[model samples]
Target chain A: SQQGEEDPQALSIQEGENATMNCSYKTSINNLQWYRQNSGRGLVHLILIRSNEREKHSGRLRVTLDTSKKSSSLLITASRAADTASYFCATEGPTDSWGKLQFGAGTQVVVTP
Target chain B: DVKVTQSSRYLVKRTGEKVFLECVQDMDHENMFWYRQDPGLGLRLIYFSYDVKMKEKGDIPEGYSVSREKKERFSLILESASTNQTSMYLCASSLWAGRPNEQFFGPGTRLTVL
Candidate 1:
C-alpha cells in the first residue's frame, strides 16, 4: 500500500497563476520530499522539509507541512508552462533506514499559455 | 552531480520471454532502487539494494527478481514477461538515506510486453 496520497488528481490553469497541491500521509515520517516529472522522463527533486520544519521555500515553490494533520502542501507561485508536470510527494518513514521513499499517487498540473 | 543511467530507454518484449533491465549509478551511492510507474498506481517499488550482493523485496515483488553483483550495477529480471508487466521502469540511487539524502533518478525505461 502507498504511504502517501495526493488530492486533486488533476488541475488546469493559465500561465502566471498559482497552483497548489496537497499530500497526506499515514505514518510518522522523518522527512517529506517533493519531486517533479516532465512527460516521459525521470523525476527531479524539488524541495524537502524535515518533520521539525514547518515551511520551506525554493525559488518560486513553497511547501508547508503540518505534523498535527499529517499533511503537506506544495504551492507554485507565478506558474508557467514549463511548470506543467506531474508533482509527487514522498515520505521517509521512521523505520525506513535505506531511504526507500513511499510516494503518493501524484497531482498533474497543467499551466496553459 | 550524481548520474544514474538505465540500459535502454525503450524496449519491446513478448510474453513468456525472459527480460533483463540494467541500471548503473556513478556516484558510488550505497543504495539503489527500482520502481514501476503506471497511470493510476503511481510509482511502486519492486526491489532495492543497499550493497553488492544484498537485496530486499519491496511492495510489489511478485514475478520479479533483482541482482546486484557489483556496487555500481543493479539488474531487474522478469522471468517471463506478461502483458500486464508493461510500464515505465525507473531506477534511483542515493547515498545512505536520511537527512539531506536526495535520490538521483535515471531517465527511465519504457518496456512493452506483447
Candidate 2:
C-alpha cells in the first residue's frame, strides 16, 4: 500500500494562475519532498520541507507542511505552460532509511496558454 | 549535473521470459532505487541498494530481484515476466539518506509483456 496520497487527481488552469496540490500521508515522516515529472520522463526534484519546518519557498513554488495533520501542500504561483506536469509528494521515513520513499499517486496539472 | 541513465527507453517481452533492466549513475551516489509506475497506482518501489552487494526489498518486490555488484550500477531482474508486470520502470539514485538526499532519476523504461 502507498503511504502518501494526493488529492485532485487532475487539475486544469490558465496561465499565470496559481495551482495548488495537496498530499496526505499515513505515518510519521522526517521530511517531505515534491517532484515534477514531464510526460514519459523521470521526475525532477522541486522542494523539500522537513517536519520541523512549517513552510518553504523556492522561486514561485511554495510548500507547506503540517506534520500534525500528516499533510502537505504545494503551491505553484504564476503558473506557466512549462509547469504542466505530474507532481508527486514523497515522504522520507524518520530513521533516514536509505531510499525508502513512500510516494503519492500524484496530481496531474495542465496549464493552458 | 547528476546523470542517472537507464539502458533502455522501451522494452517488450513475452510472458515467462527473463528481463533485465539496467541503471547507472555517474554521481557516485551510495543509494539507488527501482520503482514501477502504473496508471492509477503511482510509483511503487521494487528494490533498492545502499551499497555494493547490499539489497533490500521495497513495497512491491515479489516478482523482481536486484543485483548491485558495483557501486555505480544497479540491475533489476524479472525472473519470469508476467502480464501484470508491464509498466513504466524508473531508476533513481541519491547521495545518502535524509531530507537533503534528493534523488536523481533516469528517463525510465516502459516495459510491455505480451
Candidate 3:
C-alpha cells in the first residue's frame, strides 16, 4: 500500500515561474526522497532528505521534511519547459529493510513556454 | 556514472504466455528492484534483491517471480502472463546494502498483454 499521497494531482505553470508540490505520509519514516519522470521514460532521482534534516537544496530544487506532521514538500525555482514531468515522493517506512520505498500517487507538472 | 539497462523497450505477449524481463546494472550495486507502473498507481514494487541469489517479495509479488543470479543482473519472470499484468515495467539499482540510497532506473519496458 502507498504510505504517501502527493497533493495537487496536476499543476500547470509558465516557464520561469516557481512550482511547489506537497506530499503527506501516514507513518514515520527514515527518509524521504523525490523523483522525476518524463513521459514514456523512467524516473530520475531528484533529491533525498533525511528525517533529521529540516531542509536541503540542490541548484534550483529545494526539499523540506517535517517529521512532526509526517509531510514533505518539493519546490522548483525558475522552472523550465524541460522541467515538465511527473514528480513522485517516496518514503522509506520505519523498518530495517531500508531499500524499500513506498511511492506516492505523484504530481504532474506541466511547464508551458 | 550509474547506468541501468533493460533488455527491451517494448514487448507484446499473449495471455498465459511466459515472459522474462532482464535488468543489468554497471555500478555493481548491492540492491535491485522491479516495479510496475499503471495509470493511477504511481509505482508499485514487485520484487527486490539485495545480493546475488537472494530475493524478497515486495508489496505485489503474486503472479510474478524474480531471479538474481549475479550481482549485476536481476530478472523478473512472469510464470503466466495475464491481461491484467500489462504495465510499464521499471528496473532500478542502488548502492549500499539496505540503504535508501539514490537509485538509477533504466528506460522502462512497456509490456502489453493481449
Chain B TM-score in each of the candidates: 0.97, 0.97, 0.97
> Docking category for candidate 3?
medium
All candidates: CA RMSD (Å): 0.9, 1.0, 1.0
Report lDDT (Cα) of residue B82, candidate 3: 99
Q: Relative to the true structure, how large is the alpha-carbon lDDT of every model?
A: 0.94, 0.93, 0.93
Model 1: pairs clashing at backbone N, Cα or C within 3 Å: none
- Collision pairs in model 3: none
**Docking category for candidate 2?**
medium
Error at A8, model 2, angstroms: 0.9
Measured by DockQ, the strongest candidate is 2
Model 3 regions more than 4 Å off = A96-98
In candidate 3, what are the lDDT values of residues B1-114, reduced to their tens digit? Answer: 899999999999999999999999999899999999998799999999989999999999999999999999999999999999999999999896555588889999999999
Return the lDDT, model 2, position B30. Answer: 93
> Where is model 2 more than 4 Å wrong at Cα?
none
